[model samples]
Structure formats: structure tokens, C-alpha cells
Target: MESYTGKSIFQKVAVGRIFYYEKNENIVKRNRIEETEGEIKRFEAAKLVALGQLDRIYQKALKEVGEDNAAVFEVHKMMMEDEDYLESIHSMVREQKVNAEYAVAMTGDNFAKMFSQMDDEYMKARAADVKDISERLVSVLLGNGTDMGALKEPVILVADDLAPSETVQLDKSKILAFVTRYGSSNSHTAILARTMNIPAVIGVDISKEWNGKMAAVDGYTGTVYIEPDFDCMERMKNRIAEDEKKRQLMQELKGKETVTKAGRKIHLYANIGNVADTVSALQNDAEGIGLFRSEFLYLEAKDFPSEEEQFQAYKTVAESMGGKKVIIRTLDIGADKQVDYFNLDKEDNPAMGYRAIRICLSQPEIFRTQLRAILRASSFGNISIMFPMIISVKEVREAKRILEEVKEELKEKEVPYQDVETGIMIETPAAVFESGELAKEVDFFSIGTNDLTQYTLAIDRQNPKLDHIYDPHHPAVLKAIKMVVDNAHEHGAWVGICGELGADLTLTKTFVEMGLDELSVSPSFVLPVRNEICNL
Candidate 1:
């Protein structure tokens, strides 16, 4: 028996035989081509084929993982049509008189290197994307298929790493879990695994020799046991049964009120990134959407999304909730969620630098565009707007002033819009102190514990070295949350927590004791949280 440990992506236990995934290795050799134009033509044809493949995969992923996750394929499709990428391939083929495959390979390597060198972690992850697309194009040009082939039975899939395209294309039902030798929690593959609710562990030292052997994956502990002994297998079986029982119990709690034994109800809402995620939210019986990350529309787009585009997305999610409250957070871009079109200057400490509400206030035009969209969408269903990273009362007033101006514009134009409820995210320590005055300006306050903890601890949450001390459960952070809740209540403004800590079951009781009105988390967590609240 052999056991290895790595980082867990999802907390679930699985017992299965090991099925080592073998990715098709495309080896492109530089070949002198007499006709450069013909090579370019060939590349263009292969590009079309790749685009078609991506479209199919995108649609499939849309059904499987929802829009935000599926949007990676759309990005891949966009990459296929990127002017610079095409030109690079064409220029290489024409100037160097190389084969299409060689030109594509070289262009991919160069572009990937450029992205990999970027300071932004999000952009750096694009390196894998470039490589994935390049390999796809090369495979198409080579007259080969890039399918992972069907599996006869479910097995624990072990691989070096998986590209987003490859991961989505696999037969998901046949995959009991994923054990990768190399992957990051931020990688698209890891994100997909989480969305699919699959048990996964990354950065494991896996061996191909374990293929076809009985194995158990302890996702909670990030341990993989290959050909485990009887005692280990028995323990794994018991754990799996317990996990299954808990899932069944959670399912039974669906449609039940998230009320404590003493009859105090907590509105258990789901947080979503895009419209399609509303399906998961409703499926999990979320009372409402507490945090609709509106910035994803801008992040996913190549340029600033038009007001109409934003309206349609917001409208869809609002209508889908069927009058359930959808608190859409206004564009919280900058810092970690950087967009190229924003043209933000590089900052030494982006977390504390210009971001979120600061960007919205600095560029009111952008803020107005989003507010107009949200107001327009408000007429369709229950929709509330929230500004993120607010620290002062003045900023809240300025934001509300702009909202009123947009409302008047809509009134003048006789465009239909409802009076939307307004709120702000309590993320900074300053917000905690100013919560009394700030609460007077808004209908609600949603404690963004993720940022609050980061700021309170003065720890860079993104820095792996600080992981040891990046405690969201810190007493100071909890006190800040409590302060915000008390201040908001004093002004008759309800408060909720809509951060990673909200999903922490250990703190669920603590939050209830703090008199939190709501707890918003990912769709997968809604039922479990409700169960916890109900039992409380």
C-alpha cells in the first residue's frame, strides 16, 4: 500500500481503480515549406475547425458547469480569432517559410511565454490557455483527433495536468475523481472540478505503475491510497458512506426554512458569477442571490460591455430568481481582478491600492453605465445594487447621488425601472468604524469577510507564504463584523455576510449569534448551511 498527500480541491471521498490519463503528445518539427500562402491557408482552415470544436465544447460545458466556467471556451474561441495571434502564425509561416504546425507551435510558445511573465496571476494562467489552443490547432492540422476516449467504468483519473478544454471534453460520469501531479487551485481545470463537485487533489506524486490498482481518494485530507490495505479500504468505505449519508440528509432539507430551533430565520442565499449559475442556485433551493458578481461581465468581455449586454444578463438572473432578491455587486474590478481595457497602472500593493468602489467612483461613467443597466433590469424582478469596498459615508453618498441621476434620466426618457434597494460591502476596517453613518445611506450591509480578514490581518491573501497567518477566523475580523452588524442594526439596516467565511460551518453558529440576517455562499453550500442553521 502506498499513500501520497497533496492539496484538496473538493471535500469528498471516492474509492475506485486508478486510470492514468494519457494526453496525446503533439510533436511539431520545423519543416521548410515552399508555399507560404498554402501553409497560411491550411492554418486558417484548421483554425475554423478548432473554433467549431470549441463551440461544441462550450455548449456542453454550459450545460455541465454553467456560463462562468463555460466562458473559458468562448475565451479560447476568441483567442483563436485574436489578430495578433493570427498575425504571429502568418508572419512566421511567411517570413520563415515554415510549416503551419511549426509556425503555430512557435507562436504559441512565444505568446505563452509573454503571458507567463506577466505580474498578474490571472494573466499568468493564460499561458496554459495559449498552449492548449496551439496544441488543438496543431492536432487539427496534423489530421488527428484530440479526444480523451470513452471509459468503460468509473475510475480515479490521474494526470500530469489537464487543460480546460481537455477537462471539459472528458466523460465526467466515468471520472470518480481527479488526481493531478501538477495544478493550481486557480487553474480552470480546478475551477471546473469544483463546479462539477468532483473530488480532486492536485500536486500529487503519482505513478503510472498504479494504473488498474484499487485506490481511495480522501479529498478532505488530500490523500491518495494506491492498492491500500484492507484496514485502509474499510476506513475509506466507511467515510464514503458517511459522506453519502450527509448528502442525502442535505437533499432532504431542501425547501425547508433556514430557521433555528428558537425560530430565528436566516436568509440562506447563493452567490453567483453569471446568469447560468442561477440554475444551480435555484436547484439548491437558495432563498435568494446575496451576491451577484457583476464584474464578471466586464472581466469576460474583450472590452467594456455595453449597457444593453449588462441589462440582459442582469435581467435574466433577476427574472430567473422569480422575485427572489438578487443583490448585484457593482463593478469591483482592479487589484486581483484586473482587466486589460481598464489600463490600470501596475501597483506594488494592489489590494490596498485603487480597486472596487474606488474605481467606480473615480470613473463615474463606468459606474453610471452599470447602474443604468441594473436599474433597467430591476423592473423585471427583485434586484438590489451593492457597491463593494466602501470605507466612508461620503463615498456611499456620491454613489447614491449618481444612482439618483440615472433614475431621473430613465424617468425623463420614460424607460421602465423600479426603485432599487442600495447597499455597500463592509470590507475594510474603516468601513467597520464608519458603519453607523454608512448604514444610514444604504438599505443593507454585506460583510465581505474575505477582504475584511485580509485587511484586518494586514496579510496578502494571494501570497502563499502568508497562508499560515491569513486567518479569516481571527478575533479582530470577527469583532469587526460584529461591529458592522451592530452599527447597521442601530440605523435599521439589515446586515448579511457574503464572503468565504459565510460558508464556514464552524462560524455559522457564531454568525447567527452575531445576529446576521443572511448568509450567502456558493450554490453547493446552500443546503448544508441551511441544515446547520436549522439545527442551531
Candidate 2:
């Protein structure tokens, strides 16, 4: 028996035969071409083919992983159509007088290197994306179709790495789990695995010699056992049964109040990125919609989302909730979430730079448009508006002033709308310190622990090198959250945590003791958290 350890993406157990996946290599050789125009035509034709393939993958991913995760393919399609990328490939093919595959391979390497050298970890990950698209183009040019072939039986897939395009194309039903030699928690493959609810382990040294061998994957411990002994197999079987029992128990928790043993009730809400996610929220029995990320509308758009488009999205989510409170954070763009149409200037430090409420406040017209849309949709169901990255009471006042202006405009236009409860995200130390004054200006406070931790610790959460020290559970962060909750309550403003830490069951008791009014997490976590709170 051989055992290996790695990082886990999801917690589950599986026993299956190992399937070593080896992708067909697209080795390009440079050859002098007589007709540069012909090579350019060939490159364009391959681009079209690659784009078509990306569309099909995007549709498949959309159905399997929902819109937000599916957007990765859409980004790939956009990258394929990027004018600069296309220009580089075309110029190289024409000037270098090389085969289309060669030009594409060279251009891909150059572009990918640029992205890899970027300071932002999110941008750095794009290196893999460029390579994925480049490889696809090269394969298409060589008349080599990119397919993983069929699996006759389910198995634990082991690969060196998986590109997002490749991950989405795999047959989900046949994949018991993923055991990759190389991948990060932030990799799109990891994201897709979580979305598909497949257990995955990365950074393991896997061997093709183990192919077709019996294996047990303990995703909870990030352990892989090959040719496992009888004892190990028995333990794995028991663990799998326990996991199944826990899932069934979670389903029985639906419609149960998230209250502690002492009778303290916590409003368990779900954080969602779009209207489509409301289905998951309801299926998981979320009492309300908290942290409705409104920026996806802008991020997914070709240009600025018009008022009507924004209105329809918000309205759909609000109506879908069927009067459950939906708190929409308005246009938290910039800082990792970039839109080409916004034309935001390059920044040395984007995370703390012109982002979220700063962008909305600086560009009040854009803020006003979103406000109008939210107000227009407020009448559809229970809806509220929250401004993000606010650090001062003055910013909150300015935002509310604009909100009033938008309300007046609607009244003048004789448009029907409803008043929305206003709130601000407590994400920075400045906001925590000023929570008393800021809370007085808003109806509630949603603690965005992700940024609060980042700002309080003065650490870049996106930097993997700092991952060891980037503790969201740091004492300062906890104190900051407690302070915000206390200050908000003193000002008669309810407080809720809408960050990843909110879903940390270990802290559920602490949060309840802190007198938090609510905890909003991903839909999948709603029940587990409710169960914890109920037991507490």
C-alpha cells in the first residue's frame, strides 16, 4: 500500500480504480512558409474553431456549474478574441513567415509570461488561461481535436494539471474524484471541482504505474491510498457512510430555525452572485438573501449595464426570494474585478485602490444609475441596498444623499418604487472604528470579514506567498468584528457577517455569543451552519 498527502479542495471519500490521464501533446515546429497571407488565414480559421469550441464548453459549464463559474469559459472566449492577442499571432505569422501553429505557440508563451509576472495573484493565474487557449488554437491548426475520450467506468482521475477548458469538458458522472500533481486552491479546476461537488486533492506526486489499481481518496485529509490494505478500505467505507449520513441529516435541518440552545436566533442567509444563484439559496433553505453581489452584472457585460438590464436582474432575484430580504451591494467594481469598458487606470496596489464605494462615489452617475435600478426593483419584493468598502461616515452620508436624489428623480418621473433599507459594509479598520457614527447613518452593518482581515492585518489576501500569515482568524480581526457588532447595536443597527468566515462552524458559537443578528454564507453552508447554531 502507498499513501500520499496533498491539499484538499472538497471533503468527501471515494474508492475507485486509478485512471491516469495523459493529454495529447501539441508539439509545434517552425517551418518557413512561402505565403504569409495563407498562414494568417489559417490562424484566423483556427481562431474561429477555437472560439466555437469555447462557446460549447461555456454552455456545458453554464448548465453544470451555474453562470459565475461558467464565466471562466466566457473569459477564455474573450481572450481568444482579444485584439492584442490576435494582433500578436497575426503579426508573428506574417513577419516571421512561420507556420500558424508556431506563431500561436510563440505568442501564447510571450503573453502568458507577461501575465505570470504580474503582481496580482489573480492576474498571475491568467498565465494558465493563455496557455490553455494557445494550446487549443495549436491543436485546431494541426487538425488534432482536443478530446479526453470516454471512460468506460468511474475512476479517480490523476493528472499533472488540468486547464479550466479541460476540466469542464470531462464527464462528471465518470469522475469519482480528481487527484492532480499540480494545482492551486485558486485554480479554475479547483473551483469547478467544488462546483461539481467532486472531491479533489492537488499537489500530489502521482504515478501512471498506479493506473487501474484500486485506490481510496480521503478528501477530508487530502490523502490518497493506492492498493490499500483491508483496514484502510474498511475505514474509508465507514467514512463515506458517515459523510452520506451527515448530508442526509443536513437535509432534515431544512425549515429549522438557526437558534442556539439558549434560544438566541440567528438569521441564516445566503450570499449570492446572481439571480440564478437564488435557486441554490432556496434549495438550501436560506432564510434570506444577504450580500447579493451586484457587480457580476457589470463584470459579465460587454459595456456598462443599462438601468433596465440591472433592474431586471435585481427584480428577478428579489421576486425569486418571494419577499425574503435581499440585500444588494451596489457596483463593487475595480480591485481584481475589472471591466474593460470602465477604463480604470492601472494601479500599483489595486486592492486598496479606487474600488467598490470609492468608484461609485467618485463616479456618482454610475452609482445613480444602479441606485435607480435597485429602487425600481425594490417594489418587486423585499430589497435593501448596501455600499461596500466604506471607511468613513462622510462616505455613507454622501451615498445616502445620492440615494435620496435618485429617489426624487424616480418620484418626478412618476415611476413606482419602494424605499429600501440602506446599509454599509464593515470591511476596513476605519469602518470598525467609526462603526458607531456610520451605523447611525445606515439600517444595518454587514461585516465583510475577508477584507476586514486583509486590511486589519495589512496583508494581501491574494498573495499565496503570504498565505501562511494571512490569518482570517487573527485576534485583531476577531476583535474588530466584535467592535463593529457592538458599535452597530449601540446605534440601533443590526449586524451580520457576509464573509467566508461566517461559514466557519468553529466560530458559529462565538458569533452567536457576540450577539450577531445574522450570518450569511454560500447556499451549501446554510444548513450546516443552521445545524451548528441549533446545537449550540
Using all chains and alpha carbons, the TM-scores for the candidates as numbered come to: 0.76, 0.75
Check candidate 2 and list the clashing pairs.
Answer: 261-536
Clash count for each candidate, listed in order shown: 0, 1
Clashes of 1: 0
lDDT of 1 by residue, 174-270 (tens): 8889999876664555656766677899889998898899999999999999988999999989998998899999999998999999999999999
- Residue 143, model 1: Cα distance from true site in angstroms: 13
- Model 2, range 393-446, lDDT digits (tens) per residue? 889999999999999999999999988899999998999999989988999999
Candidate 2 segments exceeding 4 Å error: 16-198, 206-215, 226-231
In model 2, the worst 10-residue window by lDDT is 142-151
